[model samples]
Target: MATDELAGVQSVESVQSETTTKRYPVAPGVQLNVRSGPGTGYPVVKVLPTGVSVPINCQCPGTTVAGPYGTSNIWDNIANGQYVSDAYVRTGSDGYVAVRCG
Candidate 1:
């Protein structure tokens, strides 16, 4: 391939890598709820299947919850308008694992 074409391919690969978010495992055997907002007070939008992993787009403070990991107020934004309590996700940290949501 020509040098320019190679450079273009490399640039595309770099962008793709940066956009690929890491998926975190949910607590074992739990059908976790996906809330509309960051807190439990928000309505449930969906329920994650047991043993499913989720990619956290961002995190924000929310209602405190206790899960297998521990109690926390951090909520993970898996998708637009979809959130799950960070306490249920094994992000290997008791704090925020991604950028804070706006």
Candidate 2:
């Protein structure tokens, strides 16, 4: 392929990686609650099945919670208006993994 074409392909791959959604495993044996907001005070929008992984779109601080991983106030936004406690997510860190929600 021509140099320009190869460069374009490489550029596309770079963008794809940057925009790709990253999924994190939930704590074992837990049917996690998906809340409307970043806290327990928010109503449960749904429940995630056991052994499921979730893509955290963003993170924000909210009600502190204790879970299998540890205690934390960071909530992961899995979708629009949907959030789960980061404490239950095995993100390998005790702090925010994704960009803070705008």
Candidate 3:
């Protein structure tokens, strides 16, 4: 392979390694309300306890619709590839969280 090609591969590998993701343990015993939407009015789709580490898929800022929200906030099926919100997963046992791939 050419030297340029080798350099490109190394660059890509370094970038991928530098980017790290985080997980959070769902609040214990508190069956967190998985909303169908980002906000409360969206409806409680399901609930799960703590120790369930969900991947932080994407994050959205607080809007008038989803009041009292904050950073590392609202997550959804569609996300900006940062933090995750409760709406990013399906309801019920063994539900899996969504991850932003791209």
Candidate 4:
């Protein structure tokens, strides 16, 4: 995919609050690993498949977007807009519902 394509994906807004606007990534083949805790050092969370776009609720306590293998991000939901977990988030723009992919 082109770099510009990923730009459309939701970017994290520095100032976040109950009324703050939020965004999430949605890309195909976006690999994600839901960690037991904030950082690494636990079992993975189902190895999410491609097109599986997680929501970004809020930013993690101490996490960055720079990494070698997978992408780490904090997300929430579109309906509730609640920040939940810190999982491996990919830069995409689609796929909220689960669909069989090869």
Alpha carbon lDDT of each predicted model = 0.96, 0.96, 0.46, 0.40
Question: Can you tell me which runs of candidate 1 are displaced by over 4 Å?
Answer: 1-11, 14-19
lDDT of 2 by residue, 1-102 (tens): 999999999999999987798999999999999999999999999999999999999999999999999999999999999999999999999988899999
- Listing every candidate in turn, what is its Cα RMSD in Å to the true structure after a full C-alpha superposition? 2.7, 3.3, 9.6, 15.4
Which candidate's TM-score is highest? Answer: 1
TM-score of 3: 0.41
Clashes of 1: 0
Q: What is the lDDT of candidate 1?
A: 0.96
Question: Sort by lDDT, best first: what order?
Answer: 2, 1, 3, 4
Per-candidate TM-scores read 0.86, 0.83, 0.41, 0.37
lDDT of 1 by residue, 1-102 (tens): 999999999999999987789999999999999999999999999999999999999999999999999999999999999999999999999988899999
lDDT of 4 by residue, 42-80 (tens): 444445455655545434432434343244443323233
True-vs-predicted CA distance for residue 4, candidate 2, Å: 16
Which ranking of candidates, highest TM-score first?
1, 2, 3, 4
Question: C-alpha displacement of 5 in model 3, angstroms?
Answer: 17
Worst lDDT run of 10 residues, candidate 4, spans: 93-102
Question: Tens-digit lDDT track for model 3 on 1-102?
Answer: 999999999999998865654555554444555655555556665665645665455433432232122223335433232222543333231333344333
